[model samples]
Structures are given as C-alpha cells and as structure tokens.
Target: MTFPVVGMVGGGQLARMTHEAGIPLGIRFKLLSDTPQDSAAQVVNEVVVGDYRDLDTLRAFARGCDVITFDHEHVPTEHLRALEADGIPVRPGPDALVHAQDKGVMRARLDAIGVPCPRHRIVADPADVAAFAAEGDGFPVVLKTVRGGYDGKGVWVVDSVEEAEAPFRAGVPVLAEEKVDFVRELAANVVRSPHGQAVAYPVVESQQVDGVCDTVIAPAPDLDESLALHAEEMALRIAKELDVVGHLAVELFQTRDGRVLVNELAMRPHNSGHWTMDGAVTSQFANHVRAVLDLPLGDPRPRAPWTVMVNVLGGDYPDMYSAYLHCMARDPQLKIHMYGKDVKPGRKVGHVNTYGDHLDDVLERARHAAGYLRGTITE
Candidate 1:
C-alpha cells in the first residue's frame, strides 16, 4: 500500500510534533522551513529550505505531496490560493485560513456568523482608536496588527491615543477591540475532516504570561457542565462553518458574567491542546494528520481526571539536558517534550505534561518539571 505524503509549511515545533504523530501511521511528511536549523527541518527526513512568502518556493514544495497543511498561519494568503488553484489541497484553505491570519477578517466573519466575540473594528489611526474606545467602555482598548502577530507581539493595550500610536506606525492595519474583563481564558479544541466527521476535546483553561501561553489545564476546573458543552459545540460549529479540515482551537474568554466570547482562532495544533500528548486518547497532532488526509477522526476523551501542561521556557541555563536526571527522578510520571533548539532566554524550548486523579498534584508535578528544565527551579 502506498502511503500519502503530507506537506507542512513552517518548520516550528508544531511541525516537528505533527511529523512525529504521523510516524506511527506510516504517513510521510515533507517540510518547508526557513532554514535547516528550524525545529521540524532538523527532524523531518525530507525538507526544503526556503521562504514560505515566495510563490515559487511554495509551488516547488507542494509538487509531490498529497496534501498541504501548516504549522503556522503566517504564509501569504494569496500564495495558498495559488497553490489551491494548481490542484494542490491546502487543508484549512485560504478562505478559511484568512480568519486565522488576519484578526480583522476573523472578527468580521465571526460577527457575520453570529458568533459572540469582543466588540471590535479596524482603527485607521490613533484618533480612531480613541473613538473606538469612547464607543465602548473607553480607554485601555486593545490594539492589534491586522496580520503577523503572535505570542503578544503586535498587540498592545493602550490607555490613550498616544499609547496607541506605535501600532499604526508599523504601516499595517490595526484592529481595536474592547478590552474584555474576562475572569479566565479558555480553549475549545476540535478536529474535523473533509468528510464532515468531527471530534471535540474537553474545554481547557489556558494561562498566559507576557502574552505567551504558560500553562494549560485540561477539563478546566469547576467549569459548569452546560458551559463546557457550549464551548465544545461552538468550536465544532466553527470548524464546520469555516470548512477547516484539520485542527481548530478557539481561544475564548470567560467573562466575569459567565459568558464566553471568542478571542482568537488557530487553525493548527495549538499550545492549549498540547496536554493531549499524554492526556487524551488521541493527540491533536494525530487527529490533525487524519483530518487533512480525510480519514476517520479519533476519540478526544481524556485518559485521566486532570491533566496539566506547563511550558518550558529557556533561561540562564544553556544545557537543559543536565537537569533531566533531577526532573525525571523527582517525578517519574512526568512527560517531557523538548524541541531541538538552542536555549535562549524566554524562548519556548519544550513542555511538560502530568496527569493524575488529583489536580493539585498534577499541576505541581508539571510545573516543577517544566521549571526545573528551564532552570527556574532547583532541588
């Protein structure tokens, strides 16, 4: 039997992990990376080092692949459309992917679909930002670049028009949104196939630090049963509506009034769903591969009552390998996943997952292991 080759753009850790997931299914992957040092390029046997922004590079990479997908959404939308025009299958095609690539487009689409989201609009200038603020709760409005922003970059919380000037200086469209007074952040992860089959993972609480994901707790604690179901249903509905034939993570904000509003959308395996590596019956990466290949979806059920995933950020320690003995000895059940990248302060190097019946224990184990790996915790 001839197995299909999946072409993934962007060789970040997401691509690396997704490649790993496909290994078990005898699925081959071809990666397009910015450089040979990129995370996935270092692991994927077949890699083409080139820029995703160039149409020719993309065309060259897609030639022998059965289907194309992504690890990140930064690829130019027009390039993806061109690929689709050439008879290449781009899962989460340009039309559906634009929502993930541009914040303004996403908000507009969500609004048209009657999907609850933060009040938002495109701000032409700092004055328009102030006007947007005045229309809502006033001042402290959130400004984000319409495209090319992630992990808190290109996003700003401005208290006044002067503070909002920087976003407009970039020469990119800016979107102003009412700053939501959310009690906590939640993520609803779902996977869908071209055949319309879908699966939703348990709603997970996502904790962010400095605009980057820091930790994720699966089956968000004390979540009302009905609200959890609503989150799952909403995520599934979004995947179907957008014609996303892969993983879709709906980043949500649980307002103080118990309402959930959509914050962001990720059309790939997301950090919030990383806990599934050891916690779920089917990891998001595996399901993503299956979805893109149009195969039957897998179960998304949790294997344990509580599972916690903590990101391992790079720190002063350059050699994290030295600390593995201590972390492994401390908690034998901890699962560590590290990207083969050099350590740099504040860079995401890897993550740790811990699952058990006790939430507190699970949380502590995951945090400690991640901290130890990052040189934040000793003894």
Candidate 2:
C-alpha cells in the first residue's frame, strides 16, 4: 500500500527534523507556516503559508493529506476540533492537545488522576498569589502564566507577596506553585500509537541555565535503577491516561526526598529528546510520525551505551558556520545540527551530540565540542 501524506502544523525546526525523518520512512510531509522563511519551509518543499489559527487556512492545508499532526501546540483548539468534526484525521486529537495548550487545565486533570505534582493555586488576579502564599508554602514560590509559557518566559519567582503583584500589574494571568526543592531535573519520553502500542525511551537528565536548556545527559548520569524505572513508568502512565497517539515528553523533578514530581508536559517532539536523533535506535521525530500514521512503534533502545547533547545558543558564535568547522575539527565524532536561523541573542541555533560505548568519553567529547562552539574554549 502507498504511504499517506502527512500534514504538519507549524514550520519550525521540529517540523524540519520531522521532514528528515519522514524522508527515510517514504512518507510525504506538507507544512503549514505563516511565513516562507520558517525553518521547515527552507527544508521541506511542500508547504502552504497560512495562519494555523485560521480555519480556512487549516482547511486548505488539511486537504489532500492523509493525517494531520503538529510541530507545536499553538493551534487553536476550536480549529482542531472543527477539523475533526469535519472528518479530518488529527493525531493526538483535541482531547490530548488541550493538556499541552493550557497549563491550568493540565494541572487540574493530572491532579484528578493522582499524578505527583507541586502544590499549586490558580491566580485569576495577582492578589491570589499572596493568598496562596499565606496558605501554602510561602516565599520563593513560582509564578507562571497558565497559558503561553515556555522556555522561562511567562514564569517568575516571587520571594514575597509584593513580588507576586508584578504580573497582575502587567495584566498577566498567573498561577502560584510551591517552589520545588529538587535534586535534579529529568525527562521521560514515550510514543504511543492509535493501536494502543507504546514504547518508552530511557529518561535523560536536563541542565537548564536561566530557564533555557543548555545540555542533556542521556540515561541521566548516576541515576538509580529504581528512579529510572519510576520515571519510565510515570511517562507510560501519562501516555496511557491521555490516550496520546504521538510522542509525549514528561518533564519531571526529582525532589530531595527521592520523590519525582511532574513539572511540565510536551505533546510534540521536545528539545530534551533531540539527543535521540543521533543517539537512539529511533529518533523521536521518526517515532512520532509512525505513531500518528498508525504504524507499529519502533525500538526505543539506545544505539550506544551513552549519549550527550549540548545546545548551541545563537549569540555565542560570531559565525555559526565558522564555529561549526572549528568544533568538527576538534571532535569529528560529534554530530552537529544547525537550524537555518539568523543568529540572535539567546536563541537556540542548533545542537551537538556525541555517543560512545563509554559514558565518560561521550560526555567529555560532547562538552568539549559544545564549549568550543560557544567560544568558551580555543580548541
């Protein structure tokens, strides 16, 4: 049978990498982007420039495609539901999409399902922050906007009641949560199919700098077997609970007391899993495509004993291509991925990944190469 064409919403880097995965699977990928200069548009030829929030744009994009999925969760829920209502196939449908769309909705649903999470209170107004602080854990609680928060944006730390009032004064809807005292941050990833088959990847440790991820160590260095198993179990449980028919990324916090608390969720391919592209037996982008296409899930095993990925921030390099050669010359084993984006301060330009039989060797090489790219080292 001939493979079906995949229609993807959003033409960002995730879609660009997904296109790379689709090529090997013999699947056609069509992208819907608002601009011609989007990352995926530069790589994938089949694209329609349109706003994902517009039903007319969506209808046109969905036409002649066998299945619909997303690069990001920014699509209007009503538009997605309308597509389904019109008999279009949208994977990880509106029911599952909502969890990624609105953090408030996700917190409530996960809490109802008895998922482990930090104590939180919804603040329709900034005053509720002080009220929650008084009742719940006080000082240094996190203030986050329930919607449109990502990569440290829309999140703030309130040391006192006065600090919580800043967002309200700015007209932002915020939610207060007890600031988690965690030992480390971990990410569990899994992909589920429409057939109910699912596979989980090894949980990895993520290192964040000022709310942006800078590095990732796969299999999470010094991870206890029990904790690793627990993380995978938590990921599997969430995928099943949400009935998600695509890749799901569960961000977790390992508390000081050895308990893992749910931090956040991503229903699409996540930055934390980018190491899998050059490290795992099957990349998340490829698995997501297979899941949404209703194909059998691929192996989630690691190809090597260890894999480490370091993100390259845009501002660190004067010329990305020049830095690329310098890094590659030093460590040829390092695999570098450069997104076709203009260099800008604090933007994620690309990543470098290293894999090997020895975990230390992989990490050492990855770090050195990454540091070189960032101009932290001469060699």
The sequence of per-residue lDDT tens digits that candidate 2 reaches over residues 1-379 is 6889999999889999999999998878899987999889999989899899889999988988999999999888999888898788999899998998888888998898889999997887656777787786677879888778889988899887677777666675677788999998999999999889999999999999989998898889888999999989988988889888899999999999998889999999999999999999999999999999999988999898889998888665667677777777777788988778887878887888999988888888887876776677774
Cα deviation at 174, candidate 2, in Å, is: 2.1
Per-residue lDDT of 1-379 in model 1, one digit per residue for the tens? 6899999999999999999999999988999999999999999999999999999999999999999999999888899989999999999899989999999989998898889999999989988998999998899999999899999999999999899899988799999999999999999999999999999999999999999999999999999999999999999989988898899999999999999999999999999999999999999999999999999988999999999999999999999999999998989898999999999999998999999999999999999899889988887
RMSD (Cα, Å) of candidate 2? 1.4
Please give each candidate's TM-score. Answer: 0.99, 0.97
- Model 1 lDDT, full chain set: 0.94
The global C-alpha lDDT for each of the candidates, from Candidate 1 onward, is 0.94, 0.88
Error of 1 at 72 (Å): 0.7
